[model samples]
Structures are given as structure tokens and as C-alpha cells.
Target chain A: MPYEKTLEELAARRAAALAMGSPKRLAERREAGILNARERLALLFDPGSFEEAGLLAQSVRPEMAGRTPADGVVSGFGRIDGRLAGANAADFTTYGSSSAETHGKKQGFVRAACEKNGLPLVYLNECAGGRIPDIMGAAGIGRAGEGGRYTRRRSSPVLAAVLGLTYGGGAFACINADLVVMRKGSVLAVSSQMTTSVAIGEEADPQDLGGWRLHSETTGFVDAVVDTDAEAIAWIKRALSYLPDHANAATPVQADHADGDAAALLDLVPETRAKTYDIRKAIAAIADAGSVLAIKDRFAKAAVTAFARIKGRAVGIVATNPMFKGGALDPDACDKIASFIVLCDSFNLPLVFLADTPGFLVGLESERRRLPGKIMNFMAALELASVPKIALVLRKSFGQAYLNMGAGRSDTTAAWAGAEISFMDPAVAVNIVYAVKREDDPARFEDLAKEVAKGTSAYDLAAPFMAHAVIDPRETRDYLARHLDIFSRRLTGAIGDHRLADWPPAF
Target chain B: MKRTTIASEITGKVWKIEAAAGSKLAEDDPIVILESMKMEIPVSAPIDCTVVEILVAEGDTVAEGQAVAVIEG
Candidate 1:
């Protein structure tokens, strides 16, 4: 009872900070079925595990001091799936959870702490952008940019979720995150519609400006689109399960799960080169059942980038989806796969490249998109990746795409008996090398095409040791599982060199 | 009834028309098989619907994002 009055004052301050915002605003959020910042943090971390940081902090501006709770941001460290991680959730109930000087410092503290501790960082972003007037001019804007918020070294995995209208800083975090799960109704953009309309003198719908669909389908920014906040958090947790807490840490491993029927791969992938099939089916057959988590799934339809477990160990799978563009590696697909390689390599997850590409896409439009440079970037990332890589040629691996898909670059390379490794498609080669059209001289073209295809078979590549082994289609899963185990044994502690750790998260 | 225009996802010549006009189709049912990059790429119905029109015939070239069929759900 000696310091009762001081204790009372302390409790009063804590209560005020904990209250978050006016009751009416909190009630409005509840009515709208949107979780508040604190609630989101609760859902993100384990039960009673979150240790709040800067809980007593408020706005630095005198006028905004009493109104802002936790300075419009809640940041702390907690166990996500029993691994320590730092998280910052923007409190939309207060000032629309806008990024201001004080909150920016708090978020920076969490980020720095995560980096120092070598822990993953998560940003539950729903900010309204830089706080008006607070970050309007030179002094304020300079303070906002102080901690290198936009510069991501990727020392640790950074995950973000866009659960509501997210602009400027929020959008930047989402874009830079290694994994981003966006809620369906949320909008993520550099500026909100009001600012865009005023600046451009044209009205715009928020959804049209930066909807989940736009990011998922066009920009390739978001990894997954979910319907609810819980689903988004679930996705983040699931993705994090596949990654190490930090770049130097050993990749996480789980108990061996049932392997998908490898024999089904033979049925899923067509032996006939002209018959296109969904590569995902083959992927599912090759990976452990129910362990494939696709990244940028909706963006680059021609490429499939996913994290899957092969015999209980995490692996990154990059496959060509023949269903789109005849499994050609276009500029977008190249970027997608390259970014994925950077992620898997940085996190020490071994990579599995399922090659079935006809090569890079051609034509004026593809060139205009700078396909050559993108192809090189893809190859560079693949070459720079220090993680154990295993390549499996299911059908066709042609031209530079074969290298891009880890043919010679992988630690172990295998091809199905029917796999074709070629500088170009045999049919196309016949036209170019022999100057014979299929329609003009069907019989002669067939003979020449068959002649051109002679040295492109899996046996042809194997005879010279270009392919380490020629496998049966039914042995695809077993081949990868065994090779992954073999390659893993070479690693001192299942950790990679992480050569691509500093690669930009978004291309 | 909601009308939808099914678009070809790639530039290719129509190799085969699997669904005819007025044919009832289920989701993912291939309406036309396009030949591109020496592979048969199927342009399928996005939803369970009835084909109202076929915009391209077999061997006709179609550009990417080109509307190739009309359907009503």
C-alpha cells in the first residue's frame, strides 16, 4: 500500500492503452465483422504466448497523444507454431491504423528485434497509408523513411496479410513479403482511390485499383487469396511451416506422411508430346499427399511454384504447367520461378524441378516483355541457389529452359524414360534444319523429325551422363524422395549457403 | 440465365471442337482443343453451362484471350 497512488496511475495508463479506441469505433468494427488489431494478433500467435512491446506507447504529436492507443499499431514477439516470430498489426480502429512517426518506430523495433534474433516477421497490414499531416512534408516523411522500412534483406522470412484497405506502407510490406496472403475484399495499392482521383483527375473504384484478383491474377504480388482473416492467418502459418525461422537455420521437417500414388503420375502425364495435361496432378502424385502449398498459383498459369514435403522434408517444386502456353516459360513464369528459387534457397529448402517445358515462349509480345533478360534472371537465380536441387524431366526439357529448370545445374538430374532433352522441339527442328514443312512433305518430314529426335531421348542424355539416371514414370516419387535424402546427407546441418538471401523479394 | 464468353487462354489453331452449339456442358468440359507449341490445349467451360455459340471452327487460328465460345449458365 506504500505506492498505491503511483500503482493506480500505472493501471489507469495501461487500461487507457488497452482500450484501443472509442467504444463506438470498436463496435463498428465488430458490426462490420472485421477483427481489430489486437484480435488479429491474438489469432496470429499461440495462446497466451504474445509478449506485447511498446504497449504504453502513444502518438508523439501532442494533439494526437491521448487519442492514439499503442500509437495505432500493436507489435510484439510470440510463438507461431512454437517458433518465435515478430508481428505488427495495424489498429484500424485508431486513425485508420495509418503509418505515422511513432507507429513507424514501433514497427521498426519489431523488425530489428526479429532480425537480431533471427526470427521470421509477419505484418498484418490494413493501414490507410502515411498519416496525413504527420507524414505530409519533409521532416515527417524523412522520419517515416528512417528505418529502411522498404529495404528487405530477407535475413528472415517476412510474411504479410492485407485484410482491408492497405495503401502505401501497407502495400509495400505486402509486396516485399516472402509470402503474402490477401483477403478477397481487401485493396492493396500505392495510394487510395481518393488520392488517385484527386491526383489523376479520374475516379476509380478501390477494387479495380488494387483488388485481390488484380494482385492474384495480374501483378503476381499475392501468394494466396482467402475469404476471411482466419483463413489468411492459416495460410501464413502453413507457409511458414515450410520455411526455416531464419536463413541460416535448418529447414523444418515433419514426420513422414503418406506418399501420393506415384503410378498415377504415368496416367496424369501424357506420353504423347502433343497431348497436354495438368502438371499439378503429376506434382500431387510426386509430393507427399496433401503437402503441396502453391505460391503465386493464380498468377503465372504456365508455371507451378509450390512448397511441398517429399518424404517429410520440405522441398520447393517448380513445374511447367502444360495446360497453359504448352508449358512454355514466359517472362512472368520465369520471374515467378526465379523468385521462388530465391525463397527456397534462402530458407534452406531443397528444390525439385519438374521439367516439361517446350522452352521459353517466343513471339513479338514475349520479346516485348523482355523474355531474354527474364530467362537469364531465372537461370541466374537457379545457378546461384546453393540448396540441393534435383531435376526430373517428365516429358520435354528443351533449349535454355532445360538449364533454367535445373537440368545440368541440379545436384542430381534424372529423367523418365520417355523424357526428351533437346535444344528445340524435334518437329520445329525438322522445319528449321531440313526446311521441310509437315504438310508439304508429310512422310519426309516425319522421317526427318524422327531423325532429329534421335539424340534427345532420356537414354541419349543418360548415355553421356547429362542425365544421371533414366527412371520410370511410376518411380518419380521414389526417385525424388531417395535423391532428396541422398543430397540432404551432404549438407552439414541441412542448411544451405543462402547465396540468394539478399535477392529482392518482388521482381 | 447468365451469359459468359469463353476465351482461348493461348494463341493456337483450333484442333478440334469437342462441344457443339446448344450442347449442355459441365464445368471444365473442353469446348475446343487448341494446337499450340505442338500440344493440344483445351479451352474449357468455366462453369456448368450450355453452349450457345461456337466462334471458331476446327483449323481456325485464335489469338490469346480471343473469345471462342458463348455459353449460358
Candidate 2:
């Protein structure tokens, strides 16, 4: 009879804790079109798959007894698209999802569980920073679980979604995550605008403070922005589908591609070297249809970096957009490529460089941006990458940019018949060498330009074994598909070291 | 009716001015093109509006997030 009574008490306590927050508060959240913590979990995971772990953990602070349910954080293991994942959704209705001592400990446990079980960690953050009194003293200051510092273990992927106001611990987790997605109207920042305004002595509007526009275009903190929580969840599922469950596992592959005719590749790039076209068209032509997921697209216009598939196998793609600064490598573009290469190398994704760049941007503005340091950083990352590297010269590959874009010693090097590999543009070379203007000595200038361009032709370079093949522009998709398949099956002398697995996503 | 300012997303030279002041434009109509990173990014009207002012010339250098043109709906 005592055992039955104890079991009944346990069930009652669990039910009370799981109720989350006051009914009025829950109604307010719903009125604001925000999903409750439990509802977020339901949308994030497969039906009937969530097994919560901390329903009985009430806040240890005596005054807050029965006030904070699940310590304001509902954490557990669940099936995300049928694969196991560790997840936590901050219960904003409970004390504004403030960080209490028990909540921090639970989060640390959740992150560790994901690492130990070889599952991804997913965080749905809507926290309002730390609970003031709970974290005010020396004991509170020393607490380790308040932020995402426990996520240092890189054995599993950490993904975060900011659904509403996210400050302090919640902001730290999102910013530290490998990939972060945010809802349209959500705010993500180090501290709330109220606190920030008080500290900085300036009025701050929530709309302009760490908003979607700032993160997406200016800061690049968010990877994707969605209109609703459901779309954010869908994006998470899609991103997970491209990657393995853990860093140690193999990447997933899709077997079919139904993109339009591959022959359309010939029309994507212009015949005139000076004319600019969108390289995304060429990317679509070569990769499996609908498989190109671009990274940092809004940040660096000159470089097109994306994760794509060729014949179902995953690959990292880097291409120069000749339309932008003549496809030159600027400071921002250099950093973009370097970081992307590191990401692919960490995950064992083979790299494909579509070379159409003229060279590095040269000017006072470039110097001000510390182009030399950025160029060196990019070169180091490219040289250190251990994955199979392929370079395809579609039009122009000039000066040091040629080597940086995977020309020399890349596993496979190919060029279109019309491509040119040159030390610099012949026009620029002519201007530097000749004292007379083109109008004064038109014939001599034209002759000198032709002479400078002689050995730069793709056919000429291929004859000397500089390039492996000079292919027709239309055959690009077929050629890349064949080579990627060959490279994927190559014999490895040792397992991949995955050195960049711990690289900070934002830095 | 409300006024909207079209801003540049990057630091670049003004390559071309596509719309003149007082011209009526549909949503997404180009006002001016900024050349940066060797690419042309056309600053477009957010909604149906009339070009109220053109601030920068073709050769002018503009900083990121700078408003280069004004439009009134």
C-alpha cells in the first residue's frame, strides 16, 4: 500500500512539473503567436519519439519551489527524422526561461549525452538571460552550465534555433552552435536591450537590435532565417539530411537528380572573358538538381561557396563570380573560402574549385582591409586541407589566384578549351610595359598583347601537361560526376584527422 | 503614403543610376547599381514608389548600409 501511494505521488509531481507555466502566461505566449516549449519539441522531433529526462527537477532555490518546472528547460533525447538527437527547448513561460542552477546542470548533461551517444544536440532558445538572485553570488559566478561552454566537445554537431528573445546563455548557445537558424522576428544577442541600453547609455529598439537583417546580412551569425518555427524545424531536418549523425560517421547521399539538361552548362558562362554572368547557373548545371546549399551567400558576393552533390555524393564547391570585382579574391571572399574549406575538410567532403577569377583585388582599399594577411590565411587553409581537391578552369585563372583556386597539385585539374591561364591580364601587362598609348601605336600594342597571351591558352597549357584535360564546356557535368565517383572510392592510408571539427562556426 | 530609402548592402562605387528622380517604379525596380567585389548589386525599390531623390553619382564611392536613393510610395 505504501509503494502504490509513493508511485501516485511521483506521477502527480511529474504532471505538475510538466505543466510548464501559469495558464495565463501560456495563453499570452499563444496570443503572441509563439509556440510553447512542449509544442516546439513536438514540432522538432518525430511523433512518439521524445523521451524526456528531467521532468522531476524543480529549482533547488526554496522560494522558487513549484515555480520553475523542469528547471525552466525541457531537455531529453528524441528522434529527429528517425535518428536520435539530444534536444532542449527553453520554457519561456516558466520564469522567462531564466537560467537557474539546475537548468544549467541539465543543459550540461544534455550536451554530454549527445556527445556520448553519437547524436546531434538541438537547442530551441527563447531565454531571458540568468535569474538575477540565483546567479548573483560567488557560488553562482562559478557555475559552469549557464552557457554553451559544455558544448566544447565536438564529437557531435550542435544546432540552435532562436525562436524569440534570446539573451545571455541562450545567445551564447546559438552563437556557438555549428549551424544556427532563427525565426523572422526573433532577437538574439549577448544581453537584453533593456540591460544594453542601461549599460551603454543609449536607447535601443528591439527591432534593430540583433535582428534578422543584422545577423543575416551584416554579421553572418545566422545561417538561415525562416518565417515560422515550423519552417525553422523543417530547415533543421533538411540540414541534418545532408550531414552524418556525428563527425565520425559517413555523409548521407541521395541517388537521383532531375535538374534540367546538362548541355545548358554551355550557355551559363559567357564566351567573352570581360562579360560577367552568375556562376550559380553553372553550379546548378554541374551539381545534382536542387542540391546546392550555399553558405554565406549574402556576405561575400565575389565567391560562391556551397555544399552540393554530384551523382548523389556530397562535395564542397567554391567558385569565383567574374561579375563581382571581375571575380577577384577580396579580404571578405578570402575569409569566406578559407572557412568553407575548413568546414568541408573537417567533414571529409571533397572540394571542387571553379576557377574564373582574374587575381586578388589590388588597391588602397584592399590594403586597408589587410589583403596580405587574408590571402596568406586562405592559402594556408587551402594547402592544409586533406580532402581530394579538384580545379576546373572555366574561363580565366590569372596570377597567384590560379594556384590558390586549386590549380597546382590538385588531385584533378581540368580546363575548358576556351579557358586562359595567365600571369596577369595581357591588357594590364601591355599597359605596364609600353610607354606609348594604344591610339599612338595600335598595331604594335595589339601585337604585343597577342605575344603576351601566347602561352596562356588552355590548349597550349594542356599540351605541356600543365592541365590534365581540356574538355568541352558542355561535358562539365558528366566529367565532374565521373571524377567525384572515382575520388570518393579512393584508398585512404589513414583515417581523416578532422582537425577543424572544433573550429568555431562564427570565428 | 510613406517614404522608403534604398540602401547599399556593400561598400562600392556607384556604377550606374538606372532610375531618374520623379520616375514611377514598380516593386523591385532598380534605382541604382553599385559595383563592389567586381559585381553589380542593383539597389531596388521595396514597393511601388516614385523616385524622390538620387543621392550619389556614377563615380561616387558609398559605404555599406548607406542610403543612396529615396523613394515615396
Candidate 3:
């Protein structure tokens, strides 16, 4: 039949591509429990959505003739989920997937496809680094940097995944991605552990060179991280799900859910103040169930950030946990919060702030982390976020943090509430006010502390209208829902152009 | 008097403007927030000044070099 010939021809071409880049060595990729180029493409793209290009591309060199799988790069057009997505799969099996003149051609190939087609672009990077022998000459490097290929190709969004050791070119591309998700235990850096160690005269672990810890926690590099191959795929899928197929269109499809009664939140907060509970519990009960996917769980344990749905609408949740270090905004916590704010604003996710900060961290350690700059940056992120924000002061908000958390200013507000906002902690205030008396008149200090604390309580701030409204802790669920409704439908708000994705993974 | 233009570093449309034309602003006054790379990068005034012009609309794809607003000091 005519169909049989077409199928047979397709198989021959695919087999040829795999073989070009030293098919035998592809086993190293398989050994790591990851899929090969074709398999990965198949898994990533929606069923029957891929239409590949340059299948039989090969090496130009005579000695390397008939070799180079898809010219060591899998460039193609595919639909990730019925929406167009263009991509490049660098073949690590050929010359370590190093960046070479020939390899650079394929890079341009995929980037051009995405730019021209108006589809989101991705790079499945698994490389050893820059091509060694070919990159030795100045002309080779010059040709490689021709025409500002990466910099000029900024019209479309680019995402990357690091599934194996990514150094040299691989690392650059991976880090430059708008959104990067890397497999746990994999390394990504400017140089490999051995190479950097040899150069620096130190014993280096690749994990130290670029581990999940280095990028995610210390430097705020990679955006989202996953533990398994499946999670990596799902993370990519989920990220793309929220974004439009291209920059020109609307956000992708998301299902709607009915708004629930505020009564369920009557028992959301614990009756006792001292007892601690998971903040995620309150978040899930209020937002669309099963849609609260929290990002950056390991870093900044004090504040929590996640993508969720409030009545099936995409929302960004930023909350504090008094259970952690009294919910003080430390440097780590500030960096974590500031980055999340940037991400949500970029993605058009409206914000829900659950404020419970006693104040920003004080003392020497907090200062060492450059807490002032971090706090200012956090405020800058908040000020820059033109998206709708509904701030609820859950328990305690004191000092300058009260204003920074949106208690003052009509900047971008939908609603505000539920807090005990004051100048300082009454206990600390009382000690300073009566420091000379505690030893001479111990009972007097106790009475004064209690009286001052009551005046600065949640009710006092509520009566004065410093906060929008002070409600029962139980009302936080419905209160947020009402404001979130008002924020997301705003057609008039300031939004900047796309730039953050290529910021290079932090570490 | 010196004037400066601050731009966003994200891939999002300009969503909101905190400063208005003719409004006096202090150093680091937030001018605009760009929604890009899944984050909001705010462009602010570098010094105390009065707003001269806002270059971006509510929803504009401003590149790194693209000015969101201009402030005259």
C-alpha cells in the first residue's frame, strides 16, 4: 500500500538521524534513566502534533562524513498541547553535544523556527560543553558569535531543561532560558567540576559547581526544580499550560470551578495563637482544590509562594508562616518573596498576600545578608508588580514592614485586612520605655507591657482604618476570594515586555 | 536638569504605572512593573524628579532597552 511506503521511509530517516551522531554512545543517555532525542520529543509533544525538519542533516567534515545525528541537533516544530511549540534537541552522543560551527547552525535553526512561527521555543540540552578543537581559533569563535544570534533572537520565549551534565554551551543555553527546570542531582555550570578544579587548584564536586542547592537557594538562579524525570516533564507542561502558545495570543486553557461559601473558612485558623499549623491547609481550602502547586519549597521556609486557582482563575499566593521564626522577613525570606513576585507579575498571575510578619529580621545575622537592600528590592518588586494584589495581615505586622506589605498606599490594591499592625512589639517597646524600672519595680513592668500590647492589638489598627478591615481569622478565606475576583479582571494595568527568562540561572 | 529612562527586564506587557505625568517623584520611586520571565521587574526613577513622559501603554511588550517612562530631574 502507499501508506506502508511512507511509514517505512519515515523509519529509515529517523534511524539515520540517530546513527549520524554515534548511535552506540547514546546508551549513556539511556543509562541515566532519561529518554533519547526522538523519545523525548515524542513524550513532550502532544500526540500526532510533531512535524520535524532537517531529519537527515549530517556533518560537513570528510572524516566525520555520514555522521552527526540530525547534525547533532534535533530541530523541529511541534504542538505542546494543541498550541505551537518549537524546539532544539542537542545530540550529546555526537562530539559531547559541544557547541561547534555545525552545531550552532542547528541552534539558529530552532530559534529561527520559533521566532518566525511565533511559538514558544525550548532547548533539550545535554552537552559536555564548547567544541574543543574547532573553538581553538579566533575566526571560529567570531563566526559563532555572528549577528547576535541569541541576543537578537528575543522576540519569542525560550525554555530549557538540564537532564545531564551541562557545561560550556549546554550550561549557557540552559541558564539563559526564561524558565529552567533541572533534574535533581544533575550539574549545570560554566565549567565542569574537574575542569574548574584543575583550573582553580582545588578539589571540586560538580554538585558544588552547580547543584540544586547552589542555584535554587543561594543565588536564586533556576526558577522551578523537580526530583524525577516525570516531574520535570509535568513541570514543563504545567508552566506552558498557563502561558499562551505565543506572545501574540491569550493565555492557554484552564478549567473553571464554582466559588465556595466563606463559612468553610470559619475554622480555617486555629483557636489558640501559640499552636502552629500548615498554611497550605488554609490555601487549599480556599483556592480551587488540587490546583495549588507551590514553587520553591526548600528555600525560605518562612514565606510560601505558589500558583493556584481561585474559582478556576490563575492566582499567585504569597503568605507568611508565624510558625517559622515568628514570620520575620529575613534576607533569605526577602529574596524568596521578591523572586516570586517577579514571576507572578510576568505570568499575569494576580497576587494574594497573607501577611503575618512581626517585622523584618533584626540583629547582626540579618544585617550580614544585606537585609536593607533585600527589603528595598522586595518593596521594588511589589511596587513594580502592576498586577492586582489583595493583602491580608493575618496576625502581626509591625514597623516599616507594615507599609511595605501594602498597608499604606493605593498603588495596586483590591482589598486589605486581618492584622495587628503597630510601631513595634509591645513587650520590646515596654522594656525600652521602662528599662530602669524592671529591676526596681518588676510588677510595674508587667502591667505596663500588657496595657501597651492591648492598645497595639489587631482591633486598634482596625478601628483607626490603618488596615482596610480587621476581620476574624476565619474570614481570611472569603475575604481573599472577594478581592481576587476584583483583581484578575483588570484590563487596564501596566505590564513590561519579556526579559527575565534569559537572566541566566543564578549560581 | 538631567533626565533618565528606566525600563523593565521582563517579557510581559506593561501592567500598571505608579507615577503620573507631572507628578514629582523621589529617588527610587517606582515608575512601572513589567511582567516578564514569570516575575515583575519594576522600573523606577533614579533620582528625585518630576515625570516628563510615560513611554509605555498599559499593555506593551517593552524590551530591556525600551523605556517605560521618562523623568526629568
| Predicted model with the maximum DockQ | 1
Residue A36 alpha-carbon offset, candidate 3, angstroms: 1.1
Candidate 2 off by > 4 Å: A145-153, A323-326, A433-447, A492-495, B1-18, B22-50, B53-73
Q: DockQ, in order, for the candidates?
A: 0.75, 0.27, 0.01
- lDDT, model 3: 0.67
In the range A204-286, model 1's lDDT, one tens digit per residue, is 98999999889999989999999998888899999999988898788877875877789887678878977888898888888
DockQ of 2: 0.27
Tens-place lDDT digits, model 3, residues A28-99: 657767767777777778988888777776666656646566666777888887778888876777777777
* Backbone clashes in model 2, listed as residue pairs: A324-B37, A324-B38, A324-B39, A325-B37, A325-B38, A325-B39
Model 2 scores a TM of 0.89
Show where candidate 3 strays beyond 4 Å.
A1-14, A58-62, A112-118, A147-157, A246-253, A258-268, A271-275, A409-418, A436-442, A454-466, A493-507, B1-73
Candidates sorted on lDDT, descending? 1, 2, 3
lDDT for model 1, please: 0.89
The fnat score for candidate 3 comes to: 0.00
